[model samples]
Target: MTFFLQNFFNGIMLGGLYALIAVGYSMVYGILRLINFAHGDVMMMGVYFAYYSAVVFSLNPILSFTVAVLGAAALGFLIDRVAYKPLRKAPRISALITAIGVSFFLENLAVVIFGAIPKSFLDVFKDKSILEKTITVADARIPLLTFLVIIVTFAMFSVLFFVVYKTKIGMAMRAIAADIPTTSLMGVNVDNVIGFTFALGSALAAAGGIMWAMRFPNVHPYMGFVPGLKAFIAAVFGGIGSISGAVLGGILLGMIEIFLAAYFPSVMGYRDAFAFIILITVLLVKPSGLLGKKAIEKV
Candidate 1:
């Protein structure tokens, strides 16, 4: 029972990070029907930004995190403006290839500057004081960080829900997702909305990247690769284009992966295998996703 609890918490914590990235993917797909493949790399850049700000400029961790998120948002905006915007009316494949190119470009850029060596945050700032001690409830000892991750995940979702459901921008975003042509005809600034979508998604990914760095204690140019894949899977599993579904999928995927890693040592070598399996299973059983609505083709 304790083992189960421990694994469960671990999964939820891991899910928080995945959900953050997944939200970005789903949001972009929802709005533009385009997968921003560069998003994961955007997350990679965020961690680097936080790391550089903290280690070199001696900034506070909170400030460092803030700067990382803002920096990512700005970068996201730039990417959309420079790469995606001009190709809006081009072939879908063209935009997708461009996204892939952007992803590779940012990753190689990081390699050139940060090198291939994996770096850790030098000074522990935020979340550093989380007690190392674990409380044994029954046979299981639960770590403080586990609880903190769960709380943070929930809080983030609550805020996200409010912003999406209650705000005017959120309404506009949803309208655009439902029908871009109609929304544009209705006088909505489709381009600006799309840019904002990228910025918001990238910002969330940045936050997740920093929190993930805290948990894993390592950052590399390619670190985002696996996590990015898992998050994308999670987004699809829950329901691509559905905010609630993304969150749900992320948490569920996290739990499953952590449990497998914890209980199955040998299988842990294939840590991401379960994510792909889940993606396939979800697609076969419910292609629209666990929480996604069936998309109808308009003739």
Candidate 2:
């Protein structure tokens, strides 16, 4: 029971991290019907920004994290403006290929700027002593960071919920998703809404990247690759274009990952495979996703 409880908490924390990234993935897909493959790279950019701010400028973690998120949002907006805006009316394949190209460009650019060596994610928050705290549950001990991650995730999600469901901008986003041309005709600035969507998603990705770096304490040029893909899978698992589904999918994926690692130690090396397997299973069984509505086409 203790083991189960500990793993469960750990899984939830991990899921929260995935949800952060997956939300952004789903948002872009929901709004633009285009997968921003470079979304993960934006996360990587945040990690680097935070790392430099903390290590070089001697800024504390909180401020550094804030700066990182801000920088990532700007980057996302820039990417959309420069790379995607022109391709908006182009073929879907063209936009998809452009996204892939942007991903590669960011990776290589990082290599040129940061070099190939991985940087130690110096624990800037360690001195704050929050992460060092732990609580006992039966025979299990859980780190405070676990709760922190979960809390932060929900708090951010709440902000997002308010923005997505309550505001005029939220309505505009929905309208654009439904029909861009009609929304534009209705006096909504479709391009601005799309840019805001990118910024919002990129900010979430940045937060996820920072939290992930805190967990593992390392950063590299290509660090976002696998996590990005897994988060994408999580988005798919929960039903793409669905805000709630992304969260649900992320938590479920995180739990499954932890359980597999806990119970099947021998298969631990292939732990990453679990997400892909789930993706395939979800695709075969219900491509519309858990909370996703089935699309009905008028022929």
Clashes of each: 0, 0
Cα misplacement distance, residue 276 of candidate 1 (Å):
0.9
Could you tell me how far off, in angstroms, the CA of residue 259 lies in candidate 2 after the best superposition? 0.9
Cα misplacement distance, residue 21 of candidate 1 (Å): 2.3
The collision pairs in model 2 are none
The whole-model lDDT of each prediction reads 0.84, 0.88
**lDDT per residue as tens, model 2, 208-234:** 898888777779999989889988999
Model 1 alpha-carbon drift over 4 Å, by segment: 122-135, 261-266
- Structural similarity to truth (TM-score) of each candidate: 0.92, 0.95
Candidate 2 — number of clashing residue pairs?
Answer: 0
Runs in model 2 deviating more than 4 A are 126-129
Candidate 1 lDDT at 259 equals 85
